[model samples]
Target: MGMRNHELVPLQLIAVIASLKHGGCHKVLRELVRYKLVAYDATARRKSSNNEGYRLTNLGYDYLALKALSSRDAIYSVGNQIGVGKESDVYIVANENDEQMILKLHRLGRTCFRQLKNKREYLNHRQAS
Candidate 1:
């Protein structure tokens, strides 16, 4: 979908694209909606059994832009998706030096916070090793 488009997207599609579990995607989406970063529409509630849909608000787009700019390594461009895992998606990214790098977006803690916390701590410990 276009960045400016406000089309209502199904939760399943978003979950698949982000490599996040359905429950986790829903939780995060609720938070985003609460923060006004995403809009959840239930207009089809009467017509359809699955009534929920989501669309990114302008704030969400701005947040993404800010995150990109604040990164230590300047990202020149984002390329195609390289891989998709259970909890993340890997994409090809080009840095200021034109070096190709893999960018992984992790979707942790959709179902259980304990598991996410454990995994995060393990990663932090490994990084500090």
Candidate 2:
């Protein structure tokens, strides 16, 4: 999911959440639900068996705001969008610590485990060569 400084729709926000490392999206959702950080959204439907829909609770919005701030720091203050790999866009970002880091924004729109594995192989080949 790509980051945008402005507000994001639920699906786009979900995409951003899903892009994080670890089971962060699920963890966040579970915690949010437990903490009542979410509200039922009548508009969004759960089309896919794997994904369910909910609106952010007040706390959820705060969390998303923080994420947006972080993403803005990464994109604006640091290096701009540099390159697009097969599955992700690579950006060079400087954190508050002033350390340069690579932000790999996954293209969740086209993400699949099978395709990811194949792309990993390609990356490995390039690195090895």
Candidate 3:
């Protein structure tokens, strides 16, 4: 996703980009807002139309950056976004070796938990065998 300085993203757009259903997106956004991790502007306007939108708070940005840094592989730099889906975004990144790699960041939530759980179980079972 392109960085917009203090940009507010609509709920619908967030749902589409995060690959989340409306209900799930609402739930997650509510929680984030409650925690002060995301800022919500219900009176925000664009093109003279009022709309509700969300933006990451400083805390949110810092949390994401820390998470990325804690990955197993040392990341040199995060480059452009390559793809986006309902639940994640794929980005081009440089590793410690300076080799380009694709980084997929998942935006899992209540709606996607079951799917991820099943996949994890399957992988674990396969590995055990």
Candidate 4:
């Protein structure tokens, strides 16, 4: 059988934790929890407070696999960094392969309360206007 794309988010989350920073799993998982991209056993025994590790949902795996293949080329540019949500920094990455895609790197080890407050303020201003 061919490789699937659905496991990307969870696998990438794991990869980011394991490779980028060893202690980033909780931070990464917090950001991805809302994406509905992981299938995990809720009943799995917890080894500690940080025992919950994610397994890739079919969609999550597929996407990460694709990204691993595509992003192998030299980076073309870090075009622009747009703040998509509280937990992500979105960048436009163009590569030597002549492909351009949005790369959303999760902001681990930060609180998003400030972003939430700003969003609320913006909404309140719009309502008052």
Candidate 5:
């Protein structure tokens, strides 16, 4: 629930980290997996680890990070969009003390993903021609 690691975490380790009941944690994990927030690998040795477990997907990480930021008074309510760029979304957000702040969601990774998709399609068409 806290630490963010690329390595797969065993269920037992997760229970220990979150200090939650095993049964409840299992149910919650199932829900998260269903929502595509968590990715579960049944096969071990994928990451050269003997234990198979779950890890947060990119979406899950983003959700957790935003939640943490909100809890820490980094952002309060979101207002209208102030500006945006090709790889980011800028919005006016407020802090706990009602101070306005500019929150930018930098989606630079998505830009690369989009470019890859476009290039792949273009290549396929070129091959046909």
Candidate 6:
């Protein structure tokens, strides 16, 4: 999909892009929202409007990345998360031949509050003064 300024896309537009019936497209979107893969804004639907909106969550993007990797034979099984750092999580994965690999997912625009405070303790001291 091409990048758009709006995060929430209209249901009708999505239906037209996917070439699916409006009802069918809504059903698929409902399922994704139920799984927390998509965010739905029913508040946007006015009394006279039938259009709803949806946007993919971070988990949804991660799911797409995982699907692409598996389809390309880069990952077969997702093993346990071996490490968690300030910016990312490292996972041990395996390929078709059982070769071990590392998968690191970086958190964009996210951070652990506790870790952030600890890492920037000096800044906190300056503010108090």
Highest lDDT model number: 6
lDDT of 2: 0.54
* Worst window of 10 by summed lDDT in candidate 5: 120-129
Q: Arrange candidates by lDDT, descending.
A: 6, 5, 3, 1, 2, 4
Candidate ranking under TM-score, highest first, comes to: 6, 5, 3, 1, 4, 2
lDDT of 1 by residue, 1-129 (tens): 322232467788788878899999988988998999988786764454655578766557645864775485567778898897776667887888889877776665545655654555333333222
Q: How many clashes in each structure?
A: 1, 1, 4, 15, 0, 0
Error of 6 at 74 (Å): 0.8
Each model's lDDT comes to: 0.68, 0.54, 0.70, 0.52, 0.71, 0.74
State the lDDT of candidate 6 residue by residue for 101-126, as single tens digits. 99998765366654444444333443
| Runs off by more than 4 Å, candidate 2 | 1-76, 111-129
Maximum-TM-score candidate: 6
TM-score of each: 0.46, 0.31, 0.50, 0.33, 0.57, 0.70
Candidate 4 lDDT tens digits, 44-76: 343663333455554464456446746775455
Q: Which sections of candidate 1 miss by over 4 Å? A: 1-6, 44-52, 72-129
Clash tally for model 2: 1
Deviation in Å, model 5, residue 76 alpha carbon: 2.1
- Cα deviation of 9, candidate 1, in Å: 1.1
lDDT at residue 9 of model 2 (Cα atoms): 31
lDDT of 2 at 94: 74
- For residues 6-122, what per-residue lDDT tens digits would candidate 2 score against the true structure? 122354467565675445666766677788867544442226534335655445654564489587664334477899876666777777777887766656325475543444432
Q: What is the lDDT of residue 94 in candidate 4?
A: 81
TM-score of 6: 0.70
| lDDT assessment of candidate 3 | 0.70
lDDT of 6 at 59: 83
- Give the alpha carbon lDDT tens digit for every residue of 1-129 in model 3: 412422468787888889999999999989999999899877744478776688786558646774767575667778898997887677888888889887777664325755644444333333222
